[model samples]
Target: MGKATGFMDFKRQKGKEQPPLQRLKDFGEYTSRLEDEELSKQGARCMDCGTPFCHMGIEIRGMAAGCPIQNVIPEWNDLVYKGQWKEALQRLQMTNNFPEFTGRVCPAPCEGSCTLAISDPAVAIKSIERSIIDKGFENGWITARIPKTRSNYRVAVVGSGPAGLAAADQLNQQGHRVTVLERADRAGGLLMYGIPNMKLDKYIVKRRVDLLAEEGITFLLNTEVGKDITHAQLKETYDAIILCVGSTVQRVLHMEGSDAQGVIPAMDYLNGTTQSLLDGVTAPINTKNKHIIVIGGGDTGADCVATALRQGAKSVHQFGKHPALPKKRAADQPWPADPQVYKLDYAYEEAAAKFGSDPREYCIQTTKIVASSNGKLKELHTIQMDKITNDEGYIYFEEVPGTEKVWPVDFVFVAIGFDGVEQSIGEHFGVKVLNNRLYATMKNYETNTAGVFAAGDARRGQSLIVWAIREGREVAAQVHGFLEEKNIKALA
Candidate 1:
């Protein structure tokens, strides 16, 4: 503990955010960092529990309890409080490979699991984390770490997302030559396109990618493994291969008029917007002067709402099948478990500011899509739902009687979720797709094919960026071990 009574003395404080309406005018980061003195006080608030559940990195009741990458929270907090930012950054990098990305986008389950959160507000761990990394970069403390030695082993990493990048970083540090193959023109799969620029700037993603390249990790852009090259070629060329392709197949919303012209997937909308932004062109799917309807609820749905607001949508509404989360943590979500509490996310805040109210409609289910005579999406038909519990304790949603209503909508962005990795990639790599994810042994991250491994969303299903980074690090260790064992056998 930096100070024995620091937690009692200082209240948790967060960084300031740009006013919603003002921030919506441009695609830039909205949050501003606290000053050094305030940040030190925030760090001093760390109680530094003996158990330190903040970094246990475990799951409780199917929900994350703490930091998935197991960031050393207390030690870094102490270092930050003592004005040792360089030391804090070093402690942070001991586990997390990309704090910049996670600090911005991650939901911060670690804060929910903080020991201090049991009573008072949780430590502003996320803000402090972002500050440490940003300061490190500002001070030129963060740079490429080139390995002193080199191994003859060469590894090919598919997909340039968080997982693939982390795997490449780790493998390269182990003296292995690693090549990251990305289908997109730019690296950082989800970070580059799936997420909007306002949340995480492209410049931040590019800066890290450039640093990795400087450290000798080769990034092959616009070259897909199964298309530009074949699996057979990869097998012949690299000593080992790792698949980190993310879960990208969007879940379909089957309904009447599903083929309507204006119905699009959430990723499609986000990707198109980001690509056009980077290419200096107009996005094909513009929400300007349109009544936008976002189907489903979660971070993606929230993001869609925010994007539509920025695009000058005339009106916006988001639909969710689930009821609103309680303002306080429920009994089911106890201490040490990430609580499902209600609060306005960044998007909701923006929507409320622009539209006079929050645009989210919970406990509502879309039943059908109504199209015009020209087959263009005209409106959406939805019904209110009530939560029902059966005799066996199974829960389901039942449509409320006489609750059907029509919503005027110019476009519908389906943000339900993703199924898994694209099937063609799995088939080409000869990896079995079970439950919409690549079949890989959890113990070793090895797929059925020899010298081929899988990790990240492709193997674990859709998940957080922090989890993806953790899987990437673990898979690299396994790959290094497998290569070393093979080398010894060959010598024998």
Candidate 2:
């Protein structure tokens, strides 16, 4: 859709970021967008291949291969390249409900599977996307389009995360009276709390929530569904109930002295910091001048490292059970698959700039925690391990013989990931749950309850925000069809 040979003419360029050490002083977003000229060049790099897999939205070897929402990526890239920004925004919104959110936080599986990535660097699709939306906002071209007609249906959406917000937006646009229920004090569930402000500012979330409200969606905040109201009550009020309660059950460390006072869950640490920032109060847990250890080697672990660095941590280390990833795609991860490659993440860069070395300790496993005589955190005992692959294609960890070590640590943050959706929410709604996920068939998203449905992480287990958005859109269509077939009408 762009120039025929633009990929060859223009090399890939990326957005700018604040210097790592300098940005460590505050929690503001360090990244800045590229100017229009550069962004246009980036867009021009879209080769518009005959078989574009950038928007295929499929999975290979259990890894996302493209845009999960099936974004019309090449079309928007061409629009941006042609300087038709408003049209680009239109194309982006056609598939994605919240481009701003995904642009800021998504891993951009689309880029990973870009045809150009098979040879040269992929087009800067994520940066182009963020610029398009940001420009739309800056030009005041984006506004609320309140539905002109109101329907006789009411939809009560539980949870205000990405999935719930997407469903509410779709249903409200269809003229259904939609209400979003959030247990948190604010609307944007994980966006508002689970994520740190440095990555996604709370103002951005509030701005969108305000826009949604203008479009006739009601947000009931600081209200838990089971504790504040009953399922029967919701069914009596709304024509259909859609559960988007995200998978929030965090996993914890289980070992000797694992319950030490200074150990904390990764989400708790992130949420506390964000809430305190918004409320203008002290964070509940302080890391200033304290030696910190974070368990788990995922994005959450990196976030913990960054948070600790900003909070004036004396020293920081991240422990991961897995070995370091290869610099290039391995044999198992072929073309179009999201390659598990190694790169210095922002947190690692900042830590290295300040501490003179990377903070990650790969192939390490924590065995136990040692508490002081006063029952405070004292030391952490760990051992290094080697990765072993058996003939049956099974992988396992075998401990090294002489790598046992101990370090004096003051705090520990567990970032290993989540268990699943909170079971209590499902039990309250009378929905059957298996493997800690709400049991909804892929065919229709309908639960055992007649008028109730489930989607997003609650139904699919832990997943990316894009997947959640896709499910939200799909479930809204399903709910609309079900209501039409039943001929359900609001009673006066």
Candidate 3:
């Protein structure tokens, strides 16, 4: 609203990324922040629409259509346009505890729902948010503030990913004694290891974790809730327990030769490589001069392909079981929703630049993994899947008779998503595990066990980081209220 014709005058643009070829040489952040003036112009494209759907956060077609964190989008955009970065940061944080994290890895559903996107490209919300936070850091605006009052109510959080971090931060801010227990050697379960350093640097995660610690949120690393310390001990030690233990069990491809020597789960591969990077050593799953195949088509699978390329894989093939998306959004998938349009991820870009061909192969089904005589991975047998509509008008994939092919393979990374919350966690905590393999939490995020609650992927199954943070904040508010109502009857 600062400039009446701002949206008409300004164009949409995002920050620049390091060239695919040059960036593939190492694991580091690829995108660079724009200059303040350039970023302000990008912010000017918000237009101050009377009905801002950017922060509405409604779900369309079962997927999020806007910002899940309900970020005060237009307000901050106006602040950024006015060159008041500190005020913008304050507005951004009013609703979001960590705009910095969402600014980096989120898919930016907000952009999808932007009114401007219905006509032209959406406002540069992600880059603008990033610029504001980075400016806050540069000006020493972000700092740990000790709570003015201490309720002394002890709370134990059973993960340090986004959800656990958010819940812990909120509960600690309300003067509760918060302790986050992470089974990993470090905090940030998925953000630390599941995502590659190139997408989200571990130092950024560590910086926030360190800040939380400085603000008196104690983090117990390398401590497994069920193993190192029993569930009963944790319950006795803390007044409440919030289970943010994410859906960790990776889905397995139970195919022929699945037990081959070189096949590995996506998390195991991703986590090991990241830990090695942190330790200043070469990654263990060295792909130099090796043919790599990444199974599954989700972001994690895409990440596997990108990681292999960076590690000098001889060749890479990223396969998706389903058919390729349309170049343009389909009729059924219209504007304002997150349409599945055909797009190349950074991995495909790197592979195309390095090998002169895109790495992604669609409609692929791995029927078997051929093993060598020494019980190692030698080749992978695959079949092309064709979509067939049955007489009843139902569509499903069918194997084209005689379309089987075998290709030499050295490593296979299964990134087919998660099975559920780890069974051991539910069992140890004595929480009800639904048939769907996720924890059974009440509407308010409480499990059957008193003083025990679940949030994030543990309760909702595999979901976005923004959703996880929302769950974390909402659950913390509920838990704090529950603590206050010592003698009140709980809602059914």
Candidate 4:
């Protein structure tokens, strides 16, 4: 431990964010990094518990707790506390291949499971992690470690998102010839488009992609297997293939007037906006002077609201099917578990500051969308709901009586969530899918088809970037083992 009483002496300090009013004006990163000394103090707050549940990654009450990739949180916390940033970065990378992405985007289950959070505030593990990586980049310590020799075995990774990138990186390190095929014009699938540039800059994504390319991994942008090239052709050309194409099909609200012209999917809106911004062209779906309604209360919905506000929307409103959670942890939730509590994310705070109230409407359901003569959406008709338990041990929602209301809206973004991988890709490859519509996988992420594997959102459905990276790394190990065994058998 860096300091015996460090946890007691230092209180947790969160990363600062730009003023809400100022940040709403553009699509730039709002969160500010802490100074080296301040970050060290935050890291010192880690108690480094005997059990260290921060890295256990257990499921509590059906929700994930701690780091999913089993990150060595305590070890790196101590290294940072001692001002050994280079060492801290190395320890952080031991388990997590991409700390920079997770540090910026992850919900930080490690902090939620921190022993210190039982009573006092939790250690700022996420901020400390970001600091370590930022220092590594500034010092030019992060460089490509190209392999000295080649295994001569070829592997094809379909998708260039976090999972696909991690898989390619691991396979390249193992001396295998790896190539990532992306259907999008640019590499870094979701990272390149789905995510707004404010939360995660596209340049940061490009920086990592460039590093991976330098390490001898080939990235084939705009080349899609099962479409541009047949799946059979890929199977014949490469010894192994890993499918990391994330869940892209958006779930829709089957309500009246859902097919209105102004109604659009959240991913489509965010992707379109980011692409336009990156290309220095005007966004096709401009929200200028429009009253926007975003359906859903998750991160994606919040992102849509933020994006709209930045695009000069006159007003915005968000709806959630579930009721707002309590400000503090509930009775059933305890320490070492991610609490179901209310907190204002950057987007929500910005909305509150601008609208003079929280823009979220909880326990509400949109029954129908009203459109104008031009077939453009004009307003949303919604009703409040209440949660109730049924006799069959099931939960249900009942619409509250006399709570119907109509809100003026010019644009509507459905941020309900994703269904699964696009059906076309799975059908073309003939991979078996579970009842939930996700890839059916067995040991080591291998599908029913031999030498064919799956990972990330495609295999496990829509999930965090951290989970995707873990799946990618695990699948790469499986692919490497399979290739090595084949080589040995052929030699014999």
Candidate of highest lDDT: 1
Ranked candidates (TM-score, high to low): 1, 4, 2, 3
lDDT tens per residue, model 2, 1-492: 768888999999877899999999899998879988888899999998788899999999899998999999999999999999999999999999999999988888999999999989999998898898989999999999999999888999999999999999999999999999999999999999988888888999999999999999999998899999889899899989999998888999989998888999999999999999999999999899999999999998999999999999999999999999999989999989878899898899999999999999999989999999888999999999999999998999999989999999999999998887887888887888885554555489889888899888888887888999998999999998887776744322
Off by over 4 Å in 1: none
Residue 326 lDDT (model 3): 91
Candidate 1 on 309-398: residue-level lDDT in tens? 899999999998889899998999888999999999999999888888889998998888989999999989899999988999999999
Instruction: State the weakest 10-residue window (summed lDDT) of model 4.
Output: 57-66
lDDT comparing candidate 4 with the true structure: 0.90
For model 1, the run of ten residues with the poorest summed lDDT: 433-442
Clashes of 3: 0
With a 3 Å backbone cut-off (N, CA, C), the pairs that clash in candidate 3 are: none
Candidate topping TM-score: 1
What would the TM-scores of all predictions be? 0.99, 0.98, 0.97, 0.98
Each model's lDDT comes to 0.92, 0.91, 0.88, 0.90
Kindly report which residue pairs in candidate 4 clash with one another.
none
lDDT of 3 by residue, 15-88 (tens): 88999999998899998788888888888888787878788876888878888878989999988889999999
For residue 422, model 4's alpha carbon misses the true position, in angstroms, by: 1.0
lDDT score, candidate 1, position 253: 83
